[model samples]
Target: MHSSSRLFPVALVSAELRGDLTEDVYRLKPNNSPDPSVELALTRLGLPGREQRGAPVILVHGSFSNRRFWYSPRAIGLGPYLARAGFDVWIPEMRGHGLSPRNLDYSRNSVAAYARFDLPAIAAFVVEQGGQAPHWIGHSLGGTSLAAALGGGYLAPEQVASVALFGSQVSRDYWALKLPPVVWSGRFLLKRMGVIPGPRLRRGPEDEPIGLALEALRWYGLFGRFGERGNDWWAGLAEVRAPVLAVSAEGDRQDPPWACRKLFEQFGSEVREYLCLGRRQGFSENFGHVEMLVSKAAQREVWPQVLHWLERQALPLQANGAGGAAQGG
Candidate 1:
């Protein structure tokens, strides 16, 4: 580990060898974020004996979810799947989700804070420990934050080997929310609630702070931009050069394929690919938003596709073409 990593106030909260994989949970308290008291939990998974065999892969879970989304309680999911496949996998829990306790400003947390502060810290810690830039894979809001980080230059291209977004989209055009009155009214009501009850709303595994909803409403509103600063995150996407893989499910009503494709098309990466899941695409079922990453069908059909994408990132860039090859299924 680097001396800088040693200096980072990260505690090893737990460690246990589960079957062929060793699961370790870490609590990182980086001083760079606005909330110094915020401790982010990162779960590391690797084969018991081949810890350093492959490049590190960071799995960022979507909103209303946590590390468990990547690696469920039963030891199934992409985290273990990647680890078993020889890659060093790290699953990070956004503040107040899963094992990470709520911070003082829990209710105030937004994607801007996550993109500007939390992500850089997570990247720094991963790089410090892995001794190399890691591949970033995110689902839903997790993917949106990664895109924001890249666009805002919070996470530089050199700091990331590649990026893969699953069921992630930023070009939200919900008719109901797009209206000015509805947007304003929704923001007001949500902010007053302080937080969204994910379980009650049937959204996901955990509650999402109202700040996130406000941010979303702002983005979906007319004349809304992504960054907390005056930065145009979508416009800024034209500058990101990292290899990207954008995945969308055919049946994902929450984030439709068209919107997901819009997000993918904005990326300026020389190496990028788009994959859509559906029966027509040879998938067993038309995968939904959550099913694209969490269901057993995903484990059987989609995991190998992800592994293939990661393996390709390790190869030398070719001159015949930039990496933006589009494919289906």
Candidate 2:
């Protein structure tokens, strides 16, 4: 492991050889973000002796979830699946989630901070350790942050090989929330709460800082846009030329297929594809937002499709022209 005093300091906190994969946990403290004490945790998984076999993949979890979403306590999840399949997988826990310690400004954490600081630092650390740019795969809010980073130009195309988003949507047409009075009331209530209690709300496993709620409000509110700066994230999508894969589910009412498709259509990548998981699409079951990535059915049917996307993205850009077919149900 490298010394922790260097620029983009990273420390290997633990390592163990699980059943078929080697799991290593790392702590990174980049000096760029607002809170220097904030250390992000990244869990890396790879085959016992083939750590350098394929392109590295960084998996970002959604809001209210952590690294366990990718690699559960029992060692059977997408992270392990990819590691066993010969891909170096790294799962990063967002601030205050999972193994990452909460920052002093945890109450003020938002997608802007994540896109401008966290993702770039994680990508830099991965590139420094792996000696190459990594392919990024994000779920829900994780994907939203990835989109913000890409559109805001925080994560340049040269730093990323490809992008994949599962159940991620930027459009908001929720009837209740769209009402001006409801938006005002919701924003007023969220401003008083330091954080939204996810457990109490039965939303997920962890609490989300109110900052995220406020950010979402601005996005879904009247005249809402995507980034912190005046940068039009939705419009800026047309500038990203990296290969992209946007996956949606027919059962994902939280982020519907049409909304997910809208986000996909904004991408300027000539080599982008859309996938909708449903029984009508030949999938065994109608995958929901979480089921699209976590359910056992996903392991059996959807994982191979993800693997195929990764393999295709690994190809040179010049060779991707013939591979631009958008597939879904």
Candidate 3:
């Protein structure tokens, strides 16, 4: 196969196919409301309609993203595909982004908030709502949160079947969270200097929704650059004790092949897998930082591997929490 020329197939998403966004799908953490009213939005997609009917898989989006970002031309968005595969897909919009309420108290962003508020809230909700510990599939910042949650014990291993990360840097020179305060200060200065667009200015197609693009870029700026070689999720990988799959694009400047290799090595789980997708999968060589949920080529190349990995594990509802009826967020 001409990996460079191969065009991955993407399933078209129909308006009817779109899952309804409702508050009932989520379980918001108490007191944390108004500011971090962190909640996990659950929806039934794919072939099976029952929320608990399919293999439970949560699609944890990258920084500055919402649930809708997954629906792209090149990517079928795991929501629809996993749903079609008889896996109930739960898409969580991190706190301060998407429908999740913002921090009314703080003026600027805080990466730590996601680790403390969003990740836990979402994980607890999944368990409370009667779904099995899901297969956590994340991108960029989302991937980091998953690792932290696992490392910090915010989530238990039995609750998570496995993990799949796309274009995420666990620890490397370009790692985002480790950015020194000095670098952030410079970025703040750049923003003040009008070198960067204001909070709402956009760069993608005008017709396309600006929310995801803006959030993703904002995350990029806030987190700064964490090179491919700096990722270090070994602690979480070995401790979490779940199978993992890490995918990167050949030309992805943000998460080059080296970074993916590091994650694979540190996450020494025997079940772990890695793939270096090429640019022809769509997007440019710089496709390093975006969510595979938006990458059509990645959807075709990597998503199936995730699904297969999960199916091989197959955590039956009987083995998990007793099957329960689906509820609103």
Clash number by candidate, in order: 4, 0, 28
Model 1's C-alpha root-mean-square deviation from the true structure amounts to 3.9
Residue by residue across 1-329, what tens digits does model 1's lDDT show? Answer: 32235747888888998777889888888877777789899888888766355798999999999888888777899898998888889999998999999999999899988898889888888888888889999999999999999888889766799999988988766678768888878877886898899999988779999889888877867767766657888888889988998888889998998888888888898888787788766668899998998888988878878888899843222211222223522
Q: Candidate 2: global Cα-lDDT?
A: 0.85
Mind giving the per-residue lDDT tens digits that candidate 2 earns over 234-290? 788889998899888889989999898899889998888787788666667789999
- Weakest ten-residue segment in model 3 by summed lDDT: 320-329
Better of 1 and 3 by lDDT: 1
Query: lDDT at 18 for candidate 1?
Result: 77
Candidates 1 and 2 compared by lDDT, better number: 2
Which residue runs of candidate 2 sit more than 4 Å off their true CA positions? Answer: 1-6, 175-180, 314-329
- Local distance difference test values of all predictions, in order: 0.84, 0.85, 0.53
Residue 277 of model 1, lDDT score? 82
lDDT by residue for model 3 over 1-329, one digit each (tens)? 22111122111222243443211234244344345433333333444234346666777766546676664333256666766677666776664545555444433333444554566655655565445777888777677667656655556676777887777764446245245574556555544543233234552221222233332333445454322123322454555567777666666666676776676566646665565554543333334455444666557555665566578743223212222110001
Candidate 3: segments with Cα more than 4 A from true spot: 1-24, 30-52, 72-76, 106-109, 174-238, 279-292, 313-329
Candidates' TM-scores?
Answer: 0.92, 0.92, 0.65
